[model samples]
Target: MDLIRDDDENNSISANPPEGYVEPGWPALYSALHQDPQYLYQPYAIWRFTLYWTLLFYGFVFLVTGLLLLLNFTKRHPRLALLSFALWILSSLLLGLISSTIVAYALAALYNAAFLRMSTWVPPLWGAVQVLLLIFSAAANVPFFTG
Candidate 1:
């Protein structure tokens, strides 16, 4: 008795896929792999995902700083505060987003290659770098600090 079917119509798992069936590319493959429960449960995957969230949280830091400036300085020097806020948005926020994106992608790659134990420090190190950037950017734009 024949174990394998040679007829293409009868065979469900054919050696050659039908026309117009495009194989998933690297981004699709990575997306599927990242969604897998087993892959997500791994320590490296956890840290890699966490790095993305950490970047988002850093963005919130800028938001809070802008809010605080509006609340405090609006009463005394509204125009100066508004200009400072605009400058902060143009300089600090844009710089932070660009820098964070680069760092986050780099850190995710590192997390993929690093051992679980070594990967633990990636988020904190990223946080420290962001904090320094935040300080410098704020000082460069803020009226009091610039003076």
Candidate 2:
């Protein structure tokens, strides 16, 4: 979806005019009436981008952890090991609240799948933590069902 505006169709949402005057300066309410559409208009794209960031952060933790584990297998790099572990925990704590709850949940699910597939998969602990965070985020997203 274009963040700008469509050059094709004009916005048609309007109330009947009082007598014969055009309703002036209500373009803010009818955003597409002008030449720019607001961020909210592209819900799916906005959500996807936010989710990508959250997933990217989470995946970075797993990637770093896996690298550290590979180093441990070869020899020892205590400083790098500690730093990677710390970052993994921080990523877990921050991913969910960084954006929309639904986006966060989507990212967690994506991260889990990728982590599970790596040949030297990161340890399972981070994935478990992400699952729990996803539960919390999903609950937060559930509105009062009108059903």
Q: Model 2's lDDT to the true fold?
A: 0.43
**Top lDDT hit:** 1
Predicted candidate 2 versus true structure: per-residue lDDT over 1-147, tens digit per residue: 533322226332122212333222211223345644322212233344444444555666556655667577444767767676666566654653454455434544554333321111121223445555765676677785323
Lowest lDDT 10-residue stretch of candidate 2? 116-125
Best by TM-score: 1
Task: Supply candidate 2's per-residue lDDT for 91.
Answer: 63
- Candidate 1's displacement at residue 32, Å, is 16
What is the overall TM-score of model 1 with all chains considered together?
0.40
Q: Which stretches of candidate 1 lie over 4 Å from their true place?
A: 1-55, 108-147
- How many pairs collide in each candidate, listed in order? 0, 0
Question: At residue 66, what lDDT does model 2 achieve?
Answer: 59
- Listed in order, each prediction's TM-score against the native is 0.40, 0.27
